[model samples]
Target: MALLDRLRTREATVGIIGLGYVGLPLAVAAAKAGYSVIGFDVDASKVERLYARESYIEAVSPDDLAQTDHLCAWTVDFEQIATCDVVVICVPTPLNQHREPDLSFVEDTARQIAAHVTPETLVVLESTTWPGTTEEVLKPILAQSGHALGRDIFVGFSPEREDPGNATYRTQTIPKIIAGDGEAAQALMEAFYGAVVETVVTVPTPTVAEAVKITENIFRSVNIALVNELKLIYDEMGIDVWEVIDGAATKPFGYMPFYPGPGLGGHCIPIDPFYLTWRARKFDVPTRFIELAGEINTNMPAHIVHRTREVLDRAQGRGLNGAKLLLVGVAYKKNVSDMRESPAMRLMQLFEEAGAEVSFIDPHVPQIPQMREYGIFEGRAALDPGRISDAGFDAVVIATDHDAVDYAALLELGCPIIDTRNAMAKRGLPMDLVTKA
Candidate 1:
């Protein structure tokens, strides 16, 4: 189809699978661009919520529903997508028990699409995955309908660039990188997404687009590990690592600062790089840097636990058991409630195993659900200084530096604090009472 055909007809119905942080916003964007959109998800509750104009995702706006105005609807039925002009999949690609890429969600989506796929409909995989997944894994399954690609049906890959809770960027502003199996497929994808997004760049092939996404995340993982490693080194010399980082970042040309914390968290930064490394192994290529970065990032939570143990040992040789520990935040990042693969949960589990009673407090997240490890501990219901001061916690661990939290008031609580995020330094707390890791 010509670009003009899409612009004039407006018959381009967009079907988005997985009504999540990525899919919901993208569907809203497409609907705002004058295309009818249908969103499908396995979770019926999420589909029901979208119909009621209730957004569980932080990136979507309340005005988005009003602006779209009956242009979009969500469904759990897979058959409804058969009428769509374009389809996009944006599900989570989480790690399994052994830390391997779990592609079951992707496989399930492909099987569903295969049943409803028809000629001339464009299918785009927006979920982050290993290179060649679009052409190798998804294509074979989707072709089960006996439709040939580039002629009978079209397929492409476009990785989602979603920054949840970011004030400056949104789905419409972020540039999209897309590629397809052939020229016709590329044109269809570009036309489909270009109407919703401001800028769309076409790469050589779908594999290149996949690699671009992985490289962007791997760069972040590697730099974060570098800073976390340096924090430990600088701490031994009694030099404030946060101060040193701020000083070094003053140089305009050479430095891009990545801060240190208890450990890496969030769904993408901690897991996306491993998808590439796992696939690279089949090609007989060892990604040493990726492996080393993963090693450093994964070890950070345990290192923080070890440092906490040392701090307690110095106080009175009191083990983690029988110690009251307060984790400052449960969310992976500041101000966002996404807890998928959060390191704070891992730290809590490790602390509980060592006999410490762990609890957390976050204004955004009023409750932290109990896992099998940490049985049942309610988050401190209030951030009042009096409440914190009266609480009998032996130590406090700063995990997330949410703007709503008053670190000054927390310091007034008088409990010794383990400043994992350097939040105490940002609040100008005295070094006598704060220990940074």
Candidate 2:
């Protein structure tokens, strides 16, 4: 069957499972591309919000929702997905306590799909997983339906190319990397995605597609960690690492700009790389570089806390105990309101334990309820610069540097500051008031 023919007939209901950062955007794109889309999730509240056009993801605008509403519906029910022609799994693939790939979510999702597998439907795995996960782990469970691949139904893999908060490339603009088990499967999958995404790049097999996705994320993890390590070394040398990076960035060749920060956060950078490293060991290969990068990134919060302690000592006899500290931002990245795996939570707890009262200010996130790291204080509304300056804080930590923060107001506050994001120097805040780490 021709890929376009299936799409045109409306026989292909594009069902996106686990509508979070990845699935929501994909569902929006597919529905906009004229496919009937059923966005399924286990979260009932999320389903209700999507139906009302209340978006959780920053990139998925109300305009996207309005355009797709005619053909789209959100549900917590698995039975809704039974009628789908193409099922794309975009569930979370997090690591366990031992830093091993937690495949329980993926396995469970696959089992649900297996129960509904039909000869005409196409199943594609979009969650970021270890290489060989699709064929080795998913395929067998899916085949439990007594249907053979290529003959009975179609199976493929397309890693979700979701860049949350990226202004340039969105779900449809970013080219998709796809691979299928066989010729027929590849054709069906390519046509399905080509309708929504701008370009579709096909690899030889599913494993190659998996490897490509991990490599892209791991490269980011390593480079960010390298700059983070440099941030520490340069701090001890009394040189501003942020300034150094700006100067080095003038070289057009052999350099890519990566800023240092408190630590790695978000769904992809810190978590996805470890999935690859964990799987590589099964093949008797040790991913030393990837592991080292993760280690440096993970240790950054502790280092930031230590720097804050030093600043407290320099200021007064006050330890972090009862010292008023303001965390500038809580989101993992600037301009986005996602706090998953954010290091700011760790820093907040560290300061509170040392007897410091911590409050956060981010335009993106007004109030952060006490999370796992700290459970005592309820978050306040947007930070008032006038009140904060007058409040006599012992020190300020710029954990997440949101663009909305008034840089000049912070510099004029006349309080000692420990900057992990290099935002103070970048905004040309007074050198005397700023301390780097």
Candidate 3:
């Protein structure tokens, strides 16, 4: 009841850890809801940018930063978190080298919170992780502070649904799913997010909330894999998979269109499903659908490379060896600068191995940032239509079809084009020049 009163009165200071894509918008939303927010991140540069009223993430604009200037403060000091009445953990949960769930970031954040958390302060984890993480992992860690869970300090799990470039859904509009360790914790979390977002969905337990997020991603991964497999099967039969999908869309009742691209990208779709697969192994249960979808999706980049080589060979009567190619849209998706798990990296490696020189053009990403798995490709070519038309390349692969790229101009380049995204077809390009891969 006291927590409810503080939240209702907007006297609660909300602490948001990890000011990346998810945390930044959440902080903005919380501040807009009239709560004083303290944005925390380990990266000093990010903290500096926030303090300077700058937004590094494309989803968070300068206007958002300016609007929340008085309401929010940015800092790297973990000790300051003790002053927050509600602390939300929005850290990254990436997979390790062996594709195992790496909970180091979450664990480190939990330990830090335990060190500074006060009694009756609500802690909610918004990172996408496996079930039992809130109870089995976070609860035990917070207990080390000698504060009883749901009694002295409250805990909850709420998965973040942060779509980077989707203008249709913002942090406040997207329905928030929340679950807590106890009734008190659940009621407090419901009121907290309810004050900020348009809708707050409460589940029975934290495990159920975790499973809900994983289920959504797994559904997308499986359907996308199905379509990708269909693309391969139809390609051999000289049928256009995109046309088939269009025809199937006429049904409109039971069909949800999941487009096939070079491969899956972004933070959630590719990685979150596997978190469940790894957890299922603990009980000796087989997650065949998840494993099979991962297998097919992972192989798509190589398939795209093979198709590109075939199209170039048939057009110019030469192999991929020593051929010059241009890749359009290196970012994982359209209209965003996020490059996590992008298939373009795999395609670049394969093109290099095949003795082909690959250059890329992305309006959103001016310079390729350093990635953990892939080496940074120095120098980005301008996306000028005139420059692309004059550049003599053996083939051009549309890896990512951003809305900014001129598809019509790309068709006039007078080279074999492998349209992996089917953007050329959608733009009414002549079928002779554009080969849908």
lDDT winner, 2 or 3: 3
lDDT, candidates in the order shown: 0.84, 0.85, 0.90
Superposing all C-alpha atoms, what RMSD in Å does each candidate have to the true structure? 2.3, 2.0, 1.3
| Per-residue lDDT over 268-359 for candidate 3, one digit per residue giving the tens place of the 0 to 100 score | 98999999999999999999999999999999999999998888778888888999899998889988989888998889889999999887
Question: Model 2, range 1-437, lDDT digits (tens) per residue?
Answer: 74437865655788899988999999998987889999999989898888888898898988889888999988888976678889999999888878888999889998898888676778999999889999899999888878787777678999987776799999888989999889888888778888888899999999999999999999999999999998888878888888899899999999999988899888889899999888888899988999999999999998998888888788675677788888899888889988778888888877777778887788888777544334544465656666877777778899988898987777676777888877877776677877777
Between candidates 1 and 3, the TM-score winner: 3
- Give the backbone clash total of model 3: 0
> By TM-score, highest first, what's the ranking?
3, 2, 1
Candidate 2: residue 153 Cα off by (Å)? 2.3
User: In model 2, how large is the Cα lDDT of residue 345?
Assistant: 83
Model 1 spans > 4 angstroms off: 2-4, 7-9, 369-386
Local error of candidate 2 at 49, Å? 1.2
Worst 10 residues of 3 by lDDT: 376-385
Candidate 1, residues 40-108, lDDT tens digits: the string is 999899887877888877888667776785899889999987888788999888888777888889999
What is candidate 2's local distance difference test score?
A: 0.85
Q: Model 3 lDDT vs. the true structure? A: 0.90
All candidates' TM-scores? 0.94, 0.95, 0.97
- Best lDDT among the predictions, by candidate number: 3
